[model samples]
Target: MAEKVRVGVLISGRGSNFVALEEWNRRGDRAYEIALVASNDPDARGLMAAKIFGLRIWAKSHKGMERAAFDMLMDAELRRHNVQVLALAGYMRLLSPEFIRAWEGRILNIHPSLLPAYKGLDTHRRAIEAGESFAGCSVHVVTEELDDGPVLAQAKLRIRPNETPEILAQRVLKEEHRIYPEALDTFCRTLRGEAQPTISSDLKK
Candidate 1:
């Protein structure tokens, strides 16, 4: 039997998407393993979610730590877990370029926007304010430039004119739950050499 792909997830919020990934990993048919959950916010609720699954958790705050110091600590934790692939679900911090280059194409992130659009926070509100016909989420490979990485997969939903930010956010959340795990499955399968490299070449550059 082939070995399961080890995944290390990073989150900075309640971890709704993380919950979905955990559920997928629990299924007997899946080919991936949940190796660890790391959070930049010490108070992030995802830490509790990780505990519920008995997964190893790492929490580091940048309160007094320098950028390089924090990156070094995070690098140590990732290496400790021997994480073959990394996923960012609602992770808030801008990872240092050094850290990203070290992990390179192994890291994935789920962004609330369709991507190459609203890159940072307030994604839902901005989409609504723009009167967009559609708003969705994206799962992309992490690159040095924020949200500029090659796209893996995306789930899009039409925006209702009357939609509030909260409503739009919830709708986007549903797409996130679906696409994040799907992208992870794609990534893990590729790593195990069980699948062809379906990821976009644009991501590596």
Candidate 2:
């Protein structure tokens, strides 16, 4: 392993996606390593899980601070840890524009609902109500606009008959766990001029 890229994962709540990324990185056959797991809320359930892995954890409540202040605090911690890439797992906070520009092209996110559709919360419900045949998740670059970044990869699942939003969310989450790490892997590898994006492989439905 020739100095894999150092990655920091950000999350706000239960970090199932963070676990996926960490597990993948732990496999010892990757272009990146998980250096830090950070959260805005100290009580986030994911923090406890990170502890089980003995991973470095950082947390600060964003309660009173301005968004920029909180972002900078997290930013300083990331820089201190020499994190080269940021994977936003389930981070619920909106990032400040400055932070986005500071780490442009270095941040990745996993979003539910095939994107360009339900850009924010309640994605599963929207998809179910629309009578769409399929629902999916996306891993993409984090831009200033919320969930409006360039999609790097996606995994889709067909909508089941009479499916409820809760059930749909559960299914989409599985695909989210499946593809986020892969997308992050390819994004770093390709950006480093190591390989080209495999379009055929990315459309994993």
lDDT by residue (149-181, candidate 1, tens digit) is: 888887778887688999888878877887778
Candidate 1 at residue 102, lDDT? 91
lDDT value, residue 132 of candidate 1: 81
Alpha carbon RMSD to native, model 1? 4.2
Local error of candidate 2 at 34, Å?
A: 0.8
Highest lDDT scorer: 2
lDDT of each: 0.84, 0.87
lDDT (Cα, 0-100) at 27 in candidate 2: 76
Tens-digit lDDT string for candidate 2 (1-205): 3567889999999999999998877875888888999999999999998999999999999999999999999999999999999999999999999999999989999889787778999998988888888888888789999998788887778888888999888888888888888888887787678877553223433
Off by over 4 Å in 1: 197-205
List the pairs of residues colliding in candidate 1: none
TM-score of each: 0.93, 0.95
